[model samples]
Target: MNPDIYKLLIIDDHPIVAEGIAAIASRQKNITCKSITCLKDLLSVIASEQFDMCITDLEFPDTNGFQFIHILQDKLPSCKILIYTMHEEPWVIARLSELNISGAVSKHTDTSELSTAITSIRMGNKYFSEVFATLNKRKSTTEGHKIPELSKREKEVLSYLAEGLSTSQIAALLCLSSNTIQTYRKRLMEKLNAKNVAELVSKGKEIF
Candidate 1:
């Protein structure tokens, strides 16, 4: 692989989807694209090669897509990740944003949006689909009216919590101590007026 060229990996279970992404990437003179359909192959490739970016689906046969994102970030600190999946849940999008992912486009979105996401992320900017962008804007507009405003860290905790991550797992991902995560958990519950984790998650979905 030439060091001067931009390398991209496309991971999707659907063969046609992977090929489509590769085809799109092939049009760029500076980008070289490779497609894989499973986690094993993806890990194998990452072990032997470096990539500038990875576009992946949110569901995999053996692992969660967000977990894959964490693994990729750990392995290739500089590689930008863009989620290209059909998942349009607000909580999912909020979690991605909380994780500081570079960009995302739904499979249902216009193909041009994927190109825009790739270009923006390559330039160190964040990109979200128009729907998500509008949802985020509405969230901002309704803050403190229908829903209480949460601090940045509180929102981060809520995002992870909605994903069913335990406090320890969230702590490890955020580089915080277990006690600190617990503190955040307690604060989140109080702020959301929830009696417990279930209620917290329930209220969180309504808020975010």
Candidate 2:
């Protein structure tokens, strides 16, 4: 093994799927690939060895993929993650973006696109499949008329509100003043054309 090689890990419940990804990754000259079929083996390998990137499937037999992303983030803060899944929901992509995931590709994408996604992510860029991009564009076009763009802080407040947090609770969580949180709430209602908090939460659920 080359000491300077980039180490990549592929995690999926399906052994053949994992092996297929590993096979593609191994074709890179400076890349070393390891594939594991379960969370336990993934955790063990992560504990013992450092990886540059991880390609993971969302559907695991025993664990949720979103929760696994959190675990991987905690364990390997510097390792980039690329999601490979059949899920193409715009909200799912939005949630991943909120969580700051490195990139995502649909399972239906070609191996060439997978290699492109890996290369882009490794070079500190986010990659999404064309389908994801197209869906997002259409969603934005339709929603733009009704919803104004939200600032980062406003989006945070809206997300907290959707989770049933009060102004005071959101303020404390975001380390902002109660008045500030209320102001954000008001802005959210206006931008989303919401009549009240209930409506605001409903609209926020759709977009965020």
| Candidates' RMSD to native | 10.4, 11.2
lDDT of 1 by residue, 120-196 (tens): 88788988898777766665575443455678988899999899999899999999999899888876664555768
lDDT per residue, candidate 2, 1-208, as tens digits? Answer: 2458898988889888888888878877789888887878877897789888999987665655776788889999888999999977554554565566788899987888898898898778999898877866676677543345678998899888888898899999999899888777865664565668888888887666
TM-score top scorer: 1
Give the number of the best model, judged by lDDT.
1
Error of 2 at 139 (Å): 4.9
Candidate 1 clashing pairs? none
Could you tell me every candidate's TM-score relative to the true structure? 0.66, 0.64
* CA shift of 208, model 1, Å: 18
Query: Which stretch of 10 consecutive residues in model 2 shows the poorest summed lDDT?
Result: 139-148
How does candidate 1 score on lDDT?
Answer: 0.81
The reply for model 2, stretches above 4 Å from the true place, is 1-3, 138-208
